[model samples]
Target: MKTHLTILLTLSSILTFSQNIKIPSDTMVVTTHTTTVKGANINYTASTGTQPVWDKKGIPIASLFYTYYERNNVKNRAERPLIISFNGGPGSASVWMHIAYTGPKVLNIDKEGYPVQPYGVKNNPNSILDIADIVYVNPVNTGYSRMIPNKEGELPKRETFFGINADIKYLAAWINTFVTRKSRWESPKYIIGESYGGTRVMGLANELQNNQWMYLNGVILVSPADYKLYNTSQPVYSALNLPYFTAAAWYQNALPKVLQEKDLLDILPESEQYAINTLMPALAKGGFISAEEKETVANKMAFYSGLSKKVILQNNLDVPTSFFWKELLRDKSGYTIGRLDSRYLGIDKREAGSSPDFNAELTSWMHSFTPAINFYIRTHLNFKTDIKYNMFGDVHPWDNRNNNTRDDLRQAMAQNPYLKVLVQSGYFDGATTYFGAKYTMWQIDPSGKMRERFSFKGYRSGHMMYLRQDDLVAANDDLRAFIKNSLSNGKPAKYEKD
Candidate 1:
């Protein structure tokens, strides 16, 4: 009888512990720390916590894990700027920008941004935290965030949190709750998103304004992924990639000696002009173009892309980026260039394949990022949870339909005079070429009425430009300037004819 009682008690204790590990809908763990940013000693409070996502009945349906950093001893918190940051992947945690970009601490990587051993974080000297309080938010299923089951053990429908529109809707609601809870309604606000996050924040800018009734002063897109041009085989899509190809080729020293001798910046304008004026029109002509024009375009593409004319002709002048990655160094070297950041190279089992076996840059990043985030969240932030930290979660079957996010940003800017946009992209980012980002920016406000309010900055590195030391400092400085310049300074929010 005694043995049976002990066994039952042990089983009950295990069940209770398991239930506790399901992640509380609303909970917080706060820790205080001091760090120097840009030679300024700063003290800040890190609030690592989970905020509940409620259903229509106001019942908790999910929990979003976030780390919010606010500088301590602010004279008036209402006047300070608050930067809400998110990384992309639709299913990616906010880890990339959290530690590597604008956060107070950064990954312990080398100056060039390659991962170093002893994977941990160090104080980011160039963190924008000195100018603004920042919050890194992980959407549902990413990081420690997860959906909750009801008393009947029924999970919320995946449709609520996995689609483009669905993501914007819930996150906007959550932001409203967060701002209200923290009493930051009067604060100047900016939303920055990277990659797929670019698509997200574009939709969010409008969603927050119309639905949540919350407005932002600025929107920052970091290597933004505009889906319209991503997988589409349109002439614009194929042509826009030419400039990026030129950049990657230049970096690899694969371009002709004439182009290579000229500085990268000097040669890029030629490539851009060719892409817009020559290549786009030529590609649009398709096979109808005289064979002479096809050959002419092929020769120019070879000159710009560092690929032979034969290969360019083989693709019929619409050279897929995958083929470029595979063929760029096929003769010179057997290495395959990375898809996201061409600076990184990988060894493939066979060199004759059309696409790389894997994304070399992503794999290299995961090696350092995965362990650092897991360690930082648990140890530094002191948020204790046995839940597995998902770098990339399973939020798939993602509904990407009705993507009016690009236009949504335009509308948001139109509605709010104080709203401004700053687009930053890396020259060598093949996945979402810098030129494509430029095209997206231009298309956002077709009227060009809001052109002055929009700005673009390009870095020499890849998608996560901040990973490179020089770009990190420059990028944060750019953010500081953008925030400061976008502030209303008590001026009324209205268009003025100067």
Candidate 2:
């Protein structure tokens, strides 16, 4: 009996010693920094850390990496507004926005956004830190964020944070954890998302408020994509793209001499009016329309889009953006214009192809940003980690199954009447056209009751408009005004300028 008892006690002690115990997460590295913008000396705290994600049963699921910046000396941190921002690739890290426009430091790239050699970064004079503290979050499978090892000692599958609904849940949890951990629960919150991130913030606003019990003061969407409105399967999507086509044509001087001479802003509405009233119905009618009607529609599309009537008719009066992109520049040099930024042009090995070899606009800045981020994170911020940073990592099998966020945003507004939204886009951005964004906003709040809380501003650049020096300043200025207006107690005014 004594020998059996001894064996049992020895086995129990061995099992306890072999089990992996959870030590408290390593202390995060915090760097204090200062930068003067607009003649204000801003003392700020820059901290790069990971926030653990927990499941329903409180099991740790993942670690979300984030770079947080908060301005010091604020009399009331709770009264100040905080902006939580992220970039979207479903796989992209938040570095694009952080290094491009919002963070204290920005990449010193050229006017066209191509890198100047020696790949240098400098303090961003236009940083939004003057108005609000910023947090740049990298979702799972992107940047330094990753899944925690499970009992099997394997990482969780990407499904945990890659889907539309799952993404919102994890991100909402991260935001809640971040605010609570930092003790900024009382602060006025805002969210800024670019590209798919823009799509993300819409859903996140609702999720955070309804599920997490957190309310926001405002939401800023930069080049936002609307899955509902941008559907290529619908005839309306083709029609909605006309204004952008005209804008791109205008930029390339491919439009009619009369149209080219007119101010772009003045002539764009003509294109919008034509697409809405004429092209939309004709396309919807399809085969039922008379031959004469089809001919007229084709001619009008050609006139506005700078495409030949023959090609427009060949496509059945509906030219997909891919065909237009390739066809527009084929005659000129067999070069294709970029979809992200129509301003940039590239050559394709297959000149007759419908799409370009690659997106010139996207490739232009990758060289500069990738290296700059890697260097800055390690040398400047002192956030050391062996994990490879994913500037545009593969989050493949990317669950794009559900992309609708109109209802989510609308529900958020309905729940919190004080919530304001500002959508800023560039005229030259083909990825998420300004017209498409406007249509989506209108669809979201057609009654116009929320009109007072919404604002749409357009710039003369591409998807990442801040790459242009002038647009960067203008966007920052507009954002500054928007943030102040949102926090004001006065009734919000309608910002739709006809």
Candidate 3:
């Protein structure tokens, strides 16, 4: 599922690939190395900070290729703070972070998130740079980053992503170089990670605290995954997914009732409570129910799940994901929509015959980002590379299993008594669903008081809700408030921007 979220549909051929970028003679292509007991492998390049990229639209960006943006130039005016940010795909570029949150160029998203003109970047007056210097890193094989030539296929995919300990061991070595070279040892540090990066940050905090002897100031998790629920190990995962199904159904009006209510927070809890308290037991009964009785329950379930009764009962209440994709619109040429982003519902009405849902439906949009991002990078940020940026490179093969690092959570807070957090979720996001983050946080910070150290807000948008103008403004203001309150009293800031 994550692979699909990050995959690019190469078949579309929407844009032709440009030739390798020429490395200038005067420009030195530098390499840095870090060694782990696992092996000495990370590859990196650096540039002394330079120019502007763009004003946040499709407009031309003006930074020299390979130059780093020296956020420290304009000191915090008090103390120095360094915050590292990255998006999780394990394969996604930090573009979302750069363009949407910290970059000089920002898209003017609409209230409903339909893009409009004057589509340019903003100065990000609310940026944390007012409080800290932010550095965005693209993980290996994603964005303009790629595995060094010899190291390209040297390591198997599994070795790179599996075994939480292995991952942290390798990642820390790489990240340390960036921090060390920039002479940020004296600066208070923080990390911001989204999705898998969120999950990864926990372990990273542990390593940074214990191994690197660096205690972090704080960590931010946006739409994170707590593998305990996200992984396939739990049979109850199917059970938990039901509420999200209802949440999705409610938002899309897949439920029998129009559910005209505008906000998901208003509806999801009720439906979620119903699923846990009643519906789950009914579905668990399985063959005990008579055909007629089964049909009745199925209809009700469908009503709640935004699916059809016949389709619901067909698979013994284990209706496949594809059913949700196409069943809703079976009456409309079998049109199916994205489970991740419902924005671009596609036409795939033909019979899928109980087979897996078509994967390509969601890949196109993410793929579209590749060319667009490349164009912007080349034309604006003069930093160029010969490497083929893998928008969704499967650097590691997932076993479709779960190994949660929720315990690593407190190690972060414990290490840095000063750390505070804000977690944001999109009601419609299927990738790292809201409840999943809740479940993990509940376990991690069981004492509601410490848990209160974090504030979780819901958005009407999906995984990338920041793209929507309303959400973007809300997020900017909310983050600004967080920094403001944190700086003022060293307390967690609270804001509800649903």
Candidate 4:
């Protein structure tokens, strides 16, 4: 009988442990911290936690991880602005901007954004937290966020969270819950997205208004990726790449002596003008163009792109970006440039290939970011978890259909006179070229009536421009100016004539 009792006791203990070990779907851990930003000592509260995404029946389907930073001792919360931040990839965590860009801490890297030993994070003196509160959100399947299995052990459908329209729909609903929970409805709100997040905030601008009845004061796009411009065989897509090539070539000192001698900013306008006026039309002609015209276009493309005329004409005047990356430094240094940042160089097995073996910048970024995020979350923020921090999560087969986000932003701006936009891009960002970002801004409002509400700023870095120390200071200052300038300040939300 004693033996039987011992067995039962052991079974009960095991069950209790299992139940206790289950991760909480809705929970938060609050910690207090202080930092100096722009020469001001600021006290802030950091709330790190997970919130649930419920189904139509109110059943928890997924939980999203997020970190919220609120400046302490505020006179009035409603008067302060709230910035909701997200990083793109449709599968990337919020780690990039969380510990690096606008957050109070940044990765321990060199001034020019190269990885260093003793990987960890340090205080960012340029953090914009003093001017406004910030929240970094990790979407479902990224960071510690995960989908919950039902009582019957069935997971939610992929269509709910892995697509363009679906992403906007559910995220808008989630934002409503977050805003309501924090009692921030009255505060001036801004949504900022980087890379794919650019596409995201554009859609959210309208969705938050129409679906959630929530409006925003500003929308910020940093190195945004517009799908409409990408994933297409359109001539504009190929033509817009010229300016980016010029920027990359200038950085590598691959341009001709005359053009290379000029500043990158000075030479970029010439490339832009030629791309719009000359290259675009020539490419649009396709096979019907005269032989002499093709040769002339190829000669000019080689001049701007740093590729030989033979290579340009060999491809019939349509050069793939991959070829440019591999061939840019082929004869000069026998190296391949990075796809995202072109500033980083890679060694290839054979220099004759059309593309490099790996993305040098991404690999280098992971070396620092992966370790830094893991260490920061556990050490500084005091949020401990056994779950792996997925820098890049498994969210493949992403549905890209029905993406009308660009027009969505236009509609939002048209309806809300108070809504404004600020676009920031890095000159060396080859993935989503600065020129492509400008083109997107131009196409947003065809009527051009609300053009003044938009602004564009460029940096002398790559996709993650804030990674560089100098650009970090400049970028955050730009953000501060944008936020301050966007404030309504008792002005009514209606159009007025000067």
Q: Clash totals for all models, in order?
A: 0, 0, 16, 0
> In candidate 2, residue 222 scores what lDDT?
92
Could you tell me the lDDT of residue 250 within candidate 4? 94
Q: Residues 319-392, candidate 3, lDDT per residue (tens digit)?
A: 65555655655564465656654543665445564432554324643444555555545444434556465556
- What is the Cα-based TM-score of model 2? 0.91
By lDDT: ranked, best first:
1, 4, 2, 3
Candidate 2: clashing residue pairs, number: 0
Reference-based lDDT, residue 474, model 3: 77
Provide C-alpha RMSD values for all models, in order: 5.9, 8.5, 11.5, 6.3
The 10 consecutive residues of candidate 2 with the worst lDDT sum are 1-10
Residue ranges of candidate 4 with Cα displaced over 4 Å: 1-21
Better of 3 and 4 by lDDT: 4
Model 3 per-residue lDDT at 251: 59
lDDT tens digits by residue: candidate 4, 1-498: 001110001111110112344456777777788888999888888888788888998978888889999999999999999999999998999999888899999999999899998999888899999999999999888998877777766778989999888888888998999999999999999999999999999999999998899999999999999988887887546889899999999999999999999999999999999999999999999889899999999889989999999998888778888888898999999989988888999998998888889888889999999999998888777777677778888788899998999999999999999999999999999889899999999999999999999999999999999999999999999999999999999999998888
lDDT of 2 by residue, 1-498 (tens): 001110001111111111453312223567778888778888888877666778787877777678888887989887788999989876889998898888888887887677887886788888989888999998876887767776767666778887777898889988998899889888878999998888899999999999999998899999998766664587656898899999998898889888999999999999999999999999898778899999999898888888899999888887888887888878876778889889988878889877777888888878788888988887667776556788876677767677657889988997787799999999988888888888877888767777878999999988999988888889888988998888855555333446
Better of 2 and 3 by TM-score: 2
lDDT score for candidate 4 against the true structure: 0.89
| Native RMSD of candidate 4 (Å) | 6.3
In model 1, the Cα lDDT at residue 207 comes to 99
Supply the TM-score for candidate 4. 0.95
